[model samples]
Target: MDTSFVKTPQIQQLLDKAAGLQESGGNPRLKAIVRDLTEALMALIVRHDISESEFWLAMKFLGEGAGEIGLIVPGSGLEHFLDLYMDAKDAEAGRSGGTPRTIEGPLYVADAPLVEGNADLSSDPDPDAQVLHMTGTVTGPEGEPVGDAIVHVWHANSKGWYSHFDPTGEQTPFNNRRRIKLAPDGRYAFHSRMPSGYSVPPGGATDQLMQALGRHGSRPAHVHFFIEAPGYRTLTTQINFGDDPFAADDFAFGTREGLLPVPSRQGDSAYIAFDFQLQRAATAAEQGFSARSRAEAG
Candidate 1:
């Protein structure tokens, strides 16, 4: 039962063979990763004395909740770990002075409606929703306006549900989403209904796991953004409302110091004035968005 047993020659041989080290023709990088991961798991098992029943039950939970695996990844902090890892790599590389990147949740759908500069996100008015007007400028780290910048924004509805994932099925295509082509001055603005904070589905996989871990599956009222421009590194980040109750403890790990903006009451509407700064790219690859499989609107 000692953890040292997992490091024995027998376990090492088992891990090597299980990761296809004895075989040929597979990717070398993948084989190495698999071996390392298996070795870590073996150590964890010995350290925790994980029962077979407990392991199988966990696997069963994963198998049964395949659809919510995306939600579970962020809630479990794996996706956030990727973000943090990249942030550390950037810091070590002396890449500094840009908006901090964070986890891009699974709900992003590509190709929302494009607008010249400013466009109302909600096509129809909801009597119960509060109007939110947001305006910002995209500039380089030196405060110079970035040309040809595009600000892609999306958020949940007043009911704390996204357009595609809403159970009510009342939202239209690209609801509360817009891609704004910035002006020559790098200014972009839009107005939409304020989105409410949302929690995972009741009795769902993410909710169940969070509850078992004595945590809540809630995200604060926030706006998701993808800002990209030629010659500047693409910025992936979101701004949470400073006043939201869950802003300090976002379940998705999307909250960062420079990304929280407190809104001001402007008569009957709320207004948020926040600017974005992008770092100049050192290579062509940094000018484009990170390659991740995402949902696309036809």
Candidate 2:
């Protein structure tokens, strides 16, 4: 028998010490978890002949897995987890009578320009796509207008690239992005050209991981929002353009029936109006401006 492979009472004592440290907490449930982890690690050391190469390989793979977390989070459905949790909380509190919440997406820029009623937001100089007029009211759960609500909006161009992230930089001067504060009646509107659906970055780390997992990386054509007010809970959601082929199949699983914007063709513009209802802030501490303050500070 190899002396290096010998099992010793000191090894058992060290594991017991680890177990004791984990169990010393006041929570009984956490103590049980400590016991379970200690037992599992001890068993693995005894049963599996884990070579140094295999150990290093496991560490390497874990690092790669950690790096892949953001890719998996958006594509593998964890973004919806927040929505589901909030929905359940709203339902429990009898506050479910608002526009459903959706993911804010990773691309939303916090400090976009604030414009009045109908500002042209299209960055494309040619303007080949149809101009769109989107209007909406921000109302409370009791149907009262939320006059102070701010509506932040962003979307891609016809070629499926956001101004900041696209390599072209042709539209880099903050085109197709703006924020509007609701009027005294809690209404706001803006104009922008319709956007096209685009796949996630192709032939990159995100794509390589998706390809290895036999998955396609694509998101439907949609506009992103971060709506907020003094007392109401902040709402982060997206309005999907109805015409995209992947509208129903968003890889982020963010589509909701009530969140889809109805499209109508006017003489020269596509018209969309959506009303958003928000739940009132239940606590005084929750009524502060943390989200907006953070953005402003940044």
Candidate 3:
């Protein structure tokens, strides 16, 4: 038993053994990251005087929280931080002429119906929901047209429930979800209902965590997009309604300066015109990747 509060050789030896326990083979980056993470955790535990019981309890909480990691990440600002970091890198490289990226919140599903140039996102409309018509043009970084780009769009309903996550159980399989291909002129349009802002489920872990942290889990009305073309970098972003109360204060920190689309009401319907510019993929790997692949990989 070691009874010294000074420099501990046993601690260093334990860390070394732990780092070497995993067979890294030739992956020095992975090994280094693992070692760094483990050392930081150990240092944190020791510095904070965290007991074994407290550590185990925290582990159990994390295990339970793993199911909702998607929500937890954006709620904890990790997703937005990554987006910001990527934006910084892009800025540093002077590669910044395109639609800004946002969080692809955990609700994305890859199996929406594909349409040609225009789509009716909601086949059957909610009686009280405001009809929405959205049109956009997909362009390259140099403002040239990007024809045949696939754009997947999805949004919540009037009651703030996504079609896949509908609580009422009356929604169609892919209701309010559609994928549209850009026309030869790079134009696309869709018809859907204006979605309402939503809050996290009342008794769920996310809601509980927000309450514990004295935060609310409300999100503003927004439409999600996953755009992919042959030679451009895959774009994952969303368009938030300008009039939403939480537009400026999104709980997920997903809102950006240029992403808000103010609607124009026309005869019991709303219309929004937005455009997306995609950056040319500088690398082959990025050119070959799609939003679906990135979402699944993430």
Candidate 4:
């Protein structure tokens, strides 16, 4: 037989106090959420008998790895869970038949070079990289084209590193990132080199936690996109290369069906043709990209 201290009335009172239950001036919704979260965390600490030393070490990790928290969230499936939750809510609200959303990994930099219709993502070329060309269209649930949709795309370089965040200082600013404003037909095309899969920073915060949990922090070769149109809901999604070995085992759990497109080989170039289907927006608020802060280039 076993008993937990968190279940005791004393611990409950402590949790209430810590969660601002007795405060009269704080926001009710925020306070209520904090109270529930604190209670759960306290219960977990008691269940695991977490030592003071271990707890402090975790706090230190969080402090040092604050920059990588974005990676950690998706790597730990929190971002994926958010997608699932949002999908369920949409289904409940009678919304269906649109491209599935996935984790928008932490690498996107805003204000990439915008082009009309066809564009090139790689402003700087690599001699060792193979050329790739991709074409796509954005349409509605009824197969009608969503004209004037913006296709914002980005991907890692062949060496599995992104610009702005690459520590080697080898990549040019906004390398392999572009925003293509589709023509009235809702069609788009781009030229770039294939991206390579990348793992988390070795021994960094995300890596440390993943290693402790016996998991890997690698993502498959993928291209992220933000599709926005006037009357359609903005979509945050990506296309994982089906041929990549890590496609099915993405550490970030970002892999989604219909998003994995196998490229066709042609001498030194590869071609991928994929399209996007978006549902019409029921509210004006859904017509724009999320307000979450993101990195940008001047």
- lDDT, candidate 4, residue 290? 78
lDDT of 2 at 239: 89
How many residue pairs in model 1 have overlapping backbones? 0
- Which regions of candidate 2 are displaced past 4 Å? 1-71, 123-126, 266-268, 284-298
C-alpha local distance difference test of each model? 0.88, 0.74, 0.83, 0.89
TM-score of each: 0.96, 0.75, 0.90, 0.95
Global CA lDDT of candidate 4, please?
0.89
Show model 3 residue runs off by greater than 4 Å: 1-8, 21-26, 288-298
Q: Arrange candidates by lDDT, descending.
A: 4, 1, 3, 2
- Model 1 lDDT per residue over 1-298, tens place: 8989988999889988999999987999999999999889888988899999998998999998888887899898998899889889889998888888877788888999989856899865566778999988889999999758988899998889888777988888789988999888988899999888899899998889999999999999999999999999888888899999999998877788888899897666899999889999899999887787788876
- Model 3 scores a C-alpha lDDT of 0.83
Task: lDDT for model 1, please.
Answer: 0.88
lDDT of 2 by residue, 172-285 (tens): 567788888778899888888878777766775556666877878888888887788998877777889776778888877778888877578776678888888887778865
Number of colliding residue pairs in each model: 0, 0, 0, 0
Scored against the true structure, residue 135 in model 1 reaches a CA lDDT of 87
Model 3 lDDT per residue over 1-298, tens place: 2223213787666766677744646466766777778777877777778899999987887788876777888998988998999899999988878899998898776668888856899966698988999997999988899997999898998899887667788887777888897788999998888789899878777787889899999999999998899989989899989989999989999899899988998877999999999999888776543433223211
- lDDT comparison, 1 vs 4, better candidate: 4
Quick one: best lDDT, which candidate? Answer: 4
Writing each residue's lDDT as its tens digit, candidate 4 over 1-298 gives 1237777899789877877889888888988898888878777777788889988998898899999988999988999999999999998988899888998888899899888857888977777778889997889999998878888899999989999988998989998998898887888899898788999999899999999999998888999999988989999999999999999999999999988999997888999999899989999989987777799886
